[model samples]
Target: MGLSYEELMDKQQWLADELTKSIKAEFNKQNIVIANGIGRNRDGALDFSLSISDLDNPDQSPDVELIDFAKAKMKELVPDSDANVVGVPTPKQF
Candidate 1:
């Protein structure tokens, strides 16, 4: 059976919080500024879309690369949870 609504909400919250912290750390390390972000837990995975603007041009596309460390960190933090930072490097994405 699928998870109940309450269970899903709790999982979503936990995943978002954890993922946000990880990504935010990465952004800070790279001096990237985030304008907006959205997180969702679906299909038993945590995913997010973050709008980060470049340090040179805050109004333009920001560097949005989650470091390799972040991926390893997520796995360590949530051994069984499938957490991922989803972003496509393209003009349309920005």
Candidate 2:
């Protein structure tokens, strides 16, 4: 049998939460925070379009340096996985 809607939602949330934590934890900075994610891709890996909050300056747009740092860190974390880090945030998924 297939999973219920609630079950699926829970699973999705759980995955998202774990992904967020893992990503955030790898980033050893205090100014970044997780905003939201568009859920994982249907592909073979745990891909998601993520957003992050810039604690130092949340109102302004994302800095290019910050985004690059995020992408690099992500690559380091999941180098072999097919999980692509879609969006690095204008500032908001920790």
lDDT of each: 0.46, 0.49
lDDT of 1 at 25: 69
- Candidate 2: where are CA atoms >4 Å away? 1-29, 36-46, 80-94
Candidate 1 residue pairs in clash (backbone atoms < 3 Å): 53-62, 54-62
Where is model 1 more than 4 Å wrong at Cα?
1-8, 29-67, 89-94
Per-candidate TM-scores read 0.38, 0.45
Model 2 lDDT per residue over 1-94, tens place: 3333454445444544554565456555556655433334446333434465556565664566655655565555434333334433343457
Query: Candidate 2: how large is its RMSD?
Result: 7.1
lDDT of 1 by residue, 4-93 (tens): 445545555555456556666655544443322334445654343333333444344433345344456556654554444443332433
lDDT of 1: 0.46
